[model samples]
Target: MKVLVTGSQGFIGKNLLAELKNKEFPEILEVNRKTEQSTLDKYCKEAEFVFHLAGVNRPEDQSEFMDGNYGFTSILLETLKKQKNTCPILISSSIQAELDNPYGVSKKAGEDLLFEYSEETGAKVLVYRLPNVFGKWCRPNYNSAVATFCHNVAHDLSINVNDPSVEMNLVYIDDLIGEFINALNGKENTRGDFCEVPVVHVTTLGEIVELIYSFKKSREERTIPNMSKAFTKKLYSTYLSYLPSKQFSYDLKMNVDHRGSFTEFIKTPDRGQVSVNISKPGITKGNHWHHTKNEKFLVVSGEGVIRFRRIGTEEIIEYFVSGNKLEVVDIPTGYTHNIENLGETDLVTIMWVNEYFNPEKPDTYYLEV
Candidate 1:
């Protein structure tokens, strides 16, 4: 299919073009702010489908709204008409078109013109009146509050929220792309006269800011946010994408001694915690027993022997472990256990506990194994 995409450098247009290329669509003609009129005319003549995404939403002058939105639509339609090309054209209209503001008025006028053109030429038109759309690559501190909040919080910058309770209806960019591809395949989700992206998340400005702040703090706290909620999962992913390239890696506080270092890697409220432990050669650790806490240890380097014994038993059980053959040793409650590095090199082990350790009541007792 010979597809023509206007505003090819725009946030939505960039995402759509990437997916089209992934799908291996043949012959894509791009039109942007720098595209020449003659090139657009040639593209209009050969385009089998058109994605009209260029528009002005944040113009410095109010008069530019009509000129950029409605006026551009008129020019594109006229060019297509001159070539007698009546391909399926999908226009990205805003839900604000239902209002009477300058930008809304211009968008509504463009929609009206597309409807008229479709009627006159018997062409297929898919008009999507989208709500607040957000995702990765969206410009920060602009029209999208979600993008601004994510960027600001990730960078430790302050955000101004005039109305904490203001509710916003957001459609993820991936979801919008999915619906657009559906329209390309003639399977649009139409509601009355306009098309809609099926998935929408309704949230308040306060909630969005709170979640973004939590995401920022997750690194320092070695915590993982709850991702069961679809909106939170998508929002967290978007927040990480805005992190500075130089700040991609963060340092963890490692507890070090002659026996080596132990570092907490990640902690979750419901999934317990993971830690990395390193012991020097001939060093023994964990000569203790837990009342209720249990753990699993996997030696990833060197050689070690884990010794275990029931609190009331005198017999000691030993499990020899080595990096050559990976294995996990379970530490059951009420059993005194200790791991001793037997190799010449340091022993590294990954440990997973059922719960986060509490210093107030550790439930640990000293014992010999």
Candidate 2:
């Protein structure tokens, strides 16, 4: 199908085009500000479906709102009429269309025009009165507070929150595209006079700012964001998209000693912690038993022998491990355990503990295995 998309260079348009290309759509007709009238006429004649996404939200003069939003829409509809095309036309409108502001008035006029055109030509019209839409590629500091917050936070810049309690209804870009694709498939979720994106996230400005800030600090804390919530997961992905290219990588603290080094990779409050341990050749580590803490050790490189002995028992258990044949050794509670590097090179082990180490409690008791 030859799909036509206006505002092809915009945030939403770029995302839609990417998804369309990914889905292996055969043809796409794009119309941007610089596109010529002759080309638009050609696209109008050839298009099987239309995504009328071009509109002006911010302008140098109030008169330009009507010119860009309603006037351009009128021109497009007239051109389609001239071409005798009555394809499905989906328009991106705003909830503010119900208001009396100049932009809202322009958007309302555009919608009225579309309705009239649909009535006259019997064209399928899908009008979406979207809420505050957010995600990757949205312009920062212009219209969306979420975009501004993500950009500023990722860049370590300060953001002003005059009213942190201000609530917002957000539609993710991916969700919007999903709805658009559904409309293309003739399965639109129509509600009264307009169509809906199905899912909307409601959150306060303060909460959004807090989440973005936490994402920035996550690198330093070696922590991952809780992915159980839908909004948080989407917001976290958006926040990472705004990170500067040069600042993509951050250093992790590695504790180095004569035996080798250990580095904490990731820590979670409920899921415990993961660390990378390296031991020099012929070195044995972990001559201790824990009262409650338990761990799992995987030998990922070189050769090693893990030895274990239960508390108040003389019996010893051993497991030979090597990178060539990977296996995990479980260190049970109340069992004194140690690992010796048997190979000539350094031994690398991946360690996972059931809980984050606490200095105050220190459940470890020194014992030989």
Candidate 3:
């Protein structure tokens, strides 16, 4: 099928084209600002489907709204009529069309024109009265509050929230693309006056700002945002996209001593924590017993012997492990434990604990094992 996408360089237009390519659509006719009028005419003459996404939402001149929104629709429809071609054309309209402002008026005018054309020539038109569509690739500080918040927070810049109580209805770009593909396959979600993207999320302005801000602080705090909800998952993904490439990796706090270094990897409230422990040759560490907190020590590199002894008892248990044959030794509750480097090289062990360590109320106490 020949798919013609106006404003192909724009956020939604770019995402739609990528999805079409992923689906292996044969031909795509991309029309952008730099593309000549003659080229658009040629595309209209051959397009089997059209995505009319170009519009003037943030024009310098207010009068340019009508010209770019309504006037451009007129030109595109006229080209389609001149060639006597009618394909399934989708129009990206705004929910603001329900308002009485100039931009809204222009968008409503375009919608009316499409409805009239569909009525007259039996041409299929799907007009989506979209809400604040946001995702990766959207311009920051331009239109979307989500985009602006993500960009600013990722860059360590402050974001302004004018109305904390104001709630926004957002649709992720991936969801929009999925819906567009559904329409292309003749399975659109339509109602009386327009179509809608099925998945939508709503959050107060303050909540959004706070959530995105926490993402920037996650590395320092060693915490992760709650991702059980779909909205947060999408928002987190979008936030990561805005992070500078240089800031992609973060440093972990390591506890170093003469024996070796113990670096915390990741910690979770529900899933406990993981760390890497390096032991110098002939060095021993963790001569301690936990009342309730237990751990798993996996020898990942070099050779090691993990020793465990029941508290208040003389019995000792030992396990020999090495990098060549990986093994995990569990430190049971109420058992004193220690790990010793058995080889000439440093021993590296991956450690997992049942909970995040707390200095004030550590369940560990020094003991011989």
The prediction achieving the highest TM-score against the true structure is: 2
User: Model 1 compared with the native: what TM-score?
Assistant: 0.92
TM-score of each: 0.92, 0.95, 0.88
Error of 2 at 21 (Å): 1.2
Cα RMSDs, all models = 2.2, 1.7, 2.7
Q: What lDDT does each candidate get?
A: 0.94, 0.95, 0.91
For model 3, residues 1-369, the per-residue Cα lDDT tens digits are 999999899989999999999999999999888988889889988999999999887899989999989998999998899989999899999999999999999999999999999998899999999999989999998888889899998888988877899988999999999999999889999998689999989888898888888788887877777678899889999999899999999989889999899998877667788899999999999899998898998998999899989988999998999999987788899999899998999999999999999999899999988
Alpha-carbon shift of residue 195 in model 3 (angstroms): 1.6
Model 2 agreement with the true structure over 183-237: per-residue lDDT tens digits: 9999999999899899999999999999999999999899988888999999999
Model 3 residue runs over 4 Å out of place are 289-291, 294-300, 303-336, 342-346
Model 1 over residues 155-176: C-alpha lDDT tens digits?
A: 8899999999999999999999
The all-Cα superposition gives candidate 1 an RMSD in Å to the true structure of 2.2
Q: Candidate 2: which stretches are off by over 4 Å?
A: 325-328
Evaluated against the true structure, the overall lDDT of model 3 is: 0.91
State in Å the error of residue 285, model 2. Answer: 1.7
Model 3: lowest-lDDT 10 consecutive positions: 218-227
